[model samples]
Target: MAVTGISANRLELLSIADAVAREKNIDREIVIDAIEEAIQKGAKSRYGAHHDIRAKIDHKTGELSLTRHTTIVADDWEPEDELEEFNDSAMVRLRDALKRDPEAEIGKEYIEVLPPFEFGRVQTQMARQVVTGKVREAERANQYEEFKDRVGEIVNGTVKRVEYGNTIVDLGRGEGIMRRDQSIPREVFNVGDRVRTYIYDVRPEAKGPQVMLSRAHPGFMAKLFSQEVPEVYDGVIEIRAAARDAGSRAKMAVLSNDSSIDPVGACVGMRGSRVQAVVAELQGEKIDIIPWVDDEPTFIVNALAPAEVSKVVLDEDADRVEVVVPDDQLSLAIGRRGQNVRLASQLTGWQIDIITEAQDSERRQKEFAERTGLFQEALDVDETIAQLLVTEGFATVEDLAYVEAYEVAEIEGFDEDTAEELQTRAREFLERQATELDNKRKALGVEDGVLEIEGVTPQMAVALGEGGVKTIEDLADLATDEIRGGHEIRGGERVKLAGVLESFNLSQEAAELLILRARVAAGWIDASELPQPEPEPEPEFEDVEGEDAFAREYDDAEGEVEAVEPEGDTDEPQDA
Candidate 1:
């Protein structure tokens, strides 16, 4: 009866391992390894903690073996940690092992088989904990591997539970959490409810792999469209960009490779059937599917549909676009709380400023009057002459001072002597202005070294001094945004922070260059470390005809082409 019981227990151990592996969806070998470790720990607790106990189970015979290993070591061998005392039970000195075996050597391990014994309550508990911990670790690892690459894919799951407005989803193989912010506004779920979500991220944590799910992600809309539109799935159409305002509104820009198939129409389906399905899934969030184009200005115009745009001026340096709409369309273009413009900006990756035609016209008139006054005051020219200069695109006294005399003389009603007189007056006025600015800068306690940096003008030096930057070191310490202007969140609202050189309208690259030069002047960096300008490629000449010839030749010589002179000069001051 004793022999039969022992055999039955050994078979039962293997059967338990198989059941656990099957239930955990892990490999049988892993469960077997975990069991071996558990048995080894139990043996160590029973035989004495100092003994090197090991356990193994036969794969086919369902047989268990336990042993105590004594490793032979040289006399000089010591414990790895200085504070740890030598473990004499598990280790034998080489000299001591030679007494029992003549051919004893270092690293020779002698093993003594241990008889199987019944487990006590404490031992059974420890074994269970060890097996459970190892199996849990394996399950977590398996879950991570299964879901890591599934990011950006829409998945179906059942709602496992809701904690503090976060939904825990059961994805069969793993669990995913959809935080409140990631779900559609006002969307609620109960336990066991089927839910569809997008897997945006999978992060491994100590507790387990965190499967992050979302219904409001821009990618969620895109994936839904792909599922509904056959052309999008088969690569006939591509969704280039998508943006969402959760339950309120969304926008998607798509492109069609096949000209016969309209990308927007295909996504909309027959009589809006396809889009309706998506809207249902998103809890009635309005979606606008616009056809994407390579031309950024045209694409932005399409993005702001139902609102007529009069003009769009893109400032590529700042990644910003100023859109002018009809006065009546202002509310529509900006949408409720600026939603329309905001979504368009996100889709196009540009900061958008929307204004009515009246606003734009007013701003233009203000600029023209300012420029005309500047010329009139600086060059001692009459109002008519200043208006003429402003209409002719002479923005400042500096433009007339450095321009070719012939170019100025070529203006209607202006002769060579008149151009010469204007040019002389401009140069003299600029000299006086520079002297005044230099005096102002010095009065503000601006160090003379600040003016030594390349690209720093006397006016800029004065501006810097007024902004509390008086020395090269002070300028070097400023970030590009501090010098170029940016938006900052202050008191829970975004406020525009004026830059020191905001009036100068410096480009981002120009601001960085100024800081870099200041750093070099302050001895913070070697001058040689400054970036070198890339050599311009030689211009390829092609045969040009008619009006383009002169402009092309001038552009090739000057490395920049001047703006075309407006047709029919008028006293009303044509727009520049």
Candidate 2:
């Protein structure tokens, strides 16, 4: 950087390059090249600006050389830039060069050694700027290359500065910023304080590569457990899933491959030392380390700790679960501000709906009463017979009408004669309902072709007619969501939109099938070309041994399962 005086000795120039290379952590050759360019620019300022000046330095002896080059060009050769005129000082015509030397040809260079001149104030300033810019660019490239591949790693750095709630950390070789939202709430750091963070993202930008850091990411918690729990780091136990509410609380599910070792007990070391280490680093944020199970219901039960679950009903198609807990355990199951259930949902990737036992009981009774009344009206049966039919899971007249006479006769107190009579009445009721629906469909101007499409029943035709889809083409043009209810963002708020066939409780797949059938009927697609439904994957079976095998045997014999007590308080995390 101190190469201002061209009169300085050649040894001093090389010494400056060596010192700069060492200070900036760059190669000596790079620094020497930058200095040579700086000297060339200074030489051009003293010599004629249009002259072709070049400078070089001896790698070993530190000697400097300045030269002016003139190249012989053909008479037809023109300048490359359209706006620029020829430079007579840098190039010579081959016709004139032949007059001076018989061997002169195009592209032949004539070099003349020049004496070095002292650097002026203006020239020294310009040369210094050029060298400084080049060095800074090199430093940025070096920093980016050193840290780009270190993403998803935990790093230690000193707090260099804080600006507007963002912490700038000096990583010794690079700098990283932890935004306000990424840092633990209420956790403050002073300058020069050592801090540990996890790198979640690293990407190149116009200014330079950015190293994004965070302490609140779910990966941060998982990484902390891997550091403290040797089983997790060694792959003996695996962290299956993790969810965090930042400084409030976090939950992670872990499983063990070796049946002899308990994952929860291993993570929660003697007297809670291992978990406490992570808790302390996280500013006393509570952690729940649930033992992960392959069964989703069992895992959800484990995730909502310190609260007992009475029953669990899952809807696999919707990826939703309805959990029923005792009246007294409702608040505990929901947690403070729904944090427990929310974290459980995140950890399990399911939408959970929690309900009390009282509510579930009331719902069951209402459904039973509704179905009993329907059977009584449709089959012309007494209240007792209708209630018995409801208890036997007879939901609709269509189901009873199509069932085998033997199945109906199997019901207690119902003989062959009673079964025959009930079946006759169910068929009559269905015929009447179909006539009414068909009349309504006709009144709505629904084409007969719409009902001709496979899977489009009379009820669906009525619904589609009311929804303004009166023809097969109209039905074929509709999206599946338009028939299977969904939410949409409107005016910055999520608004619920009712589907045309939402009352039928159609699944997404069923809705798609209906539309595909309509499209085929409309001549929009060939029936043979329709996409087939993929087969469900077979469930994996693992060989069980040790406690797992014992538990399964016990469950089979006793008709119930015993929950394993993780060796820690239910409120704290015991595993990774």
Candidate 3:
């Protein structure tokens, strides 16, 4: 067949499709599909547009065919189903179709061969454009599918162009975009520079697939190490966690599967060759390779290596840790602008606070003295008794009041009578303190609604009122964190909303419950409207006999229908 000024050759068409597919790095089938679609469009222009025209290509020979398709239907058929639309060009009566095929049936398609058209210059140009557009679209879809699963993988590409601080990388088969923020700090790139980046995201858009590349991502450093270290790549040395300060510094926690292999030594290589390679790729980003430990305190000590830890105190409830180091190591442990502790926190998933041994010792002495003084004043006990109580882990008057008589008596140099007296004094002191706080709450104009919440004591209510949260609605408006920690204002000034609640020492769960109660009281939520679990579905009767028996048994069961009916429906079914 010949187009107006164009000739169709099966071998030449196949060659062109193979070349295009190779150049686009797409499947040859996609190129053939594009060609078929382009030919179908051209056929529609040459023939009637209203005809149900279709086109296909012979995969092996690349021979193209254009045809008109008509659906065979009953002679008296009326379009009822959504698929059976009335169209003269799409359907043929059964009788008419049977003339061509005596065994023709309704819903079977009839294909009529059409003569291939000769294409004009304008038509050829249009077909070429259509094929090119389809190929480009297919290329994008292929790119998306290829890179979507590769997210979090490290990719190597050459810098193609830099536009407004955004680097466009030629990934050989596709392009990737590295936004300025995703690049390492102060890192510079030029055209044709070899770049290694993490494929952080692949977004499919109308224009094309957006392949997001990043160098500052922690995963990039992990991948770099994986590439440099055989043990890491082989999963013998597993990177437990990584935290990066971009081009400045990074910390990684690694664990070894084989007890014989040292994770840190494997990552560092001989004379730091392995780690140095990763650092060079990151533009000299200093990386600290620490061995991962299951014990958090020991792990933190490892993370803060080179700084000898004098003591480590963990506040498990708050997920925070305090590291006390030697006076000389304090600066090193904290790092410049607290980077060391910050990275350690990130790696360990805990909040870390560092202090000198001297400072920690001073704080401890102060706390002991304060507890001794509190017991002395509240329990009317002497220094010795107060010291004993403090040493026994009684930090507050409330602790002494709430302890069992036997527990108090178990302390050294204390009997049952002494325990009872101490308990009485503790309770009396607390009652007096509560009375004073209640008077203050009233004086502060704290509403009764605010005082009624479970976690809000009289002192907390007064604090809330002082902080401008005088109503139940005000307390309800506060977030759980706000009630627990309050917020810091400008110039480091903290607005203490629930700071007074610290005396009560409520747990996070208690504080949240208190906030929920306040919300309920403020009519923000219904207390009884908690989410209920969905009931399990009834078992299906698998056998036909069982199913039929169930149906009959259910039908004979009296009041079964009435029991399942909606409440308050009085209408009954008439006798059928």
Candidate 4:
């Protein structure tokens, strides 16, 4: 198995390729290709470069063969001028090819076996480098293919290196990285320590496959629970949603397919054995297992466990929930640093506002007073009648005027006749108010363009006219927040131009809709243009450098203010 005049053994070449393939976890064929390419390079160095030379190795016998190949051209294949342009290295005349092979025909190839050449130290070193480079490239391709489909699965690896708070893990077949922010709070790893992480992402880069692993990800806990709980793994129970404040606490919602088996109880295991195993792996992060309910309010109540909810008012249009807890349970519902409600919000996919029963009652009282005053002033009704209307949840004159007679009659202390009379008074009062506002709007020189816009009531038009927003274009120029809450100026003074629509008690959502319609009317935006919700920015954890290395991973107040309708009638109108 040795080549003449060469110090390296041919059999040893195959052995080396096998060893490298095993160590690098690449295919043996890839290593063989590298070896053949390196041999071809060495042979080319010995022979002339102009000759077409190739090398092949026997898969089992480890025998190497080197040969030169030339294309056979027919003697009468082309005109004399065309033949003259053909290069000698690429083609041989049929008559000349027949000397080597009497049976040579047109389009056939002439092969000449060449004796193996001796390799010098420099040439051998160069060949080794070529083989190494090719094998390294093959290794990278193998690594990328192996882990690409494994994203979102948990992988166990040993810490191979740590640089600048980033840990590189040797996963046996591939390497992964856990970035500083992706690691759990206050968690640390030294070289050779076993680490378990979630394969969050896998990206192909110039260097190699970048396997992004995470310990802080919510999916990581889900995977851990799947491993510990056989019910979860077997699909008897499904994890509907999960939220984690890594190393601090987590919440998971599970649903059971079998009615007899409780999802929460299955996840909790017998006497907390299963969840405890997951907790130990997560460094003692507290977990709350909740049964998943189809009803949103019930699901939300389950998410905010251990906190008794007195009432839940859902604003479905805005994807928000106003939760009222018993006065003593308010602090528990909110949790320390607002963690409980924040996790519940994340799990439920709804923004939540937690208030005590006392606070809710007070708010309701204030709303009742505001509506009572509006009815008293608008319909010239007494305080008793106004209070009765407010108690029945008639928040606007429009609601009373347009509601079914039976709906109003169902109110206490009101018959069908009284309901009809109240509706008449409500409609008449609204008509007179609209006429007065129209007169004021005309006197203020409000343009017809502003008046024609939908959502701009006559009263709103007068307010806009007073604020110098006399045209649709002027109204369209305002920002969404500006229309919702007028911005404050220097020295605590506020600009009132944007407050024109706010005076009508429009929700932020309604105000934005009004401005959008105005923009459409002014030809600034098309009617087909729809508003898209902005993506929430990822929270940045503050790195606290100390013995603990504590990282604060959650924000105190994470909920965004959504557009909520006014709870009472619009405030009493000012003199036009």
TM value for model 2? 0.76
Full ranking by lDDT = 1, 2, 4, 3
Give the alpha carbon lDDT tens digit for every residue of 284-349 in model 1. Answer: 999988877665666777788767666677666667877888999999999999998999899999
* TM-scores, each model vs. reference: 0.86, 0.76, 0.73, 0.68
lDDT score of residue 395 within candidate 3:
77
Q: Between prediction 1 and prediction 3, which has the larger lDDT?
A: 1
Candidate 4: tens digits of C-alpha lDDT, residues 306-384: 7876666676656888888899998889999999999999999999999898998999889889999999987888999
Worst 10-residue lDDT window for candidate 3 reads: 557-566
Per residue, candidate 2 scores C-alpha lDDT tens digits across 494-561 of 99988898898777888998898888888899898777878999987677433212122123322333
List where candidate 2 sits over 4 angstroms from the true fold.
1-21, 26-138, 446-457, 471-493, 504-532, 538-576
lDDT of 2 at 541: 66
Models sorted by TM-score, best on top: 1, 2, 3, 4
Model 3: per-residue Cα lDDT over 479-523, one tens digit each: 766666666576777665545355555668667777778889989
Residue 189 miss distance in model 4 (angstroms): 1.4
| Clash number by candidate, in order | 0, 2, 4, 0
* lDDT comparing candidate 3 with the true structure: 0.80
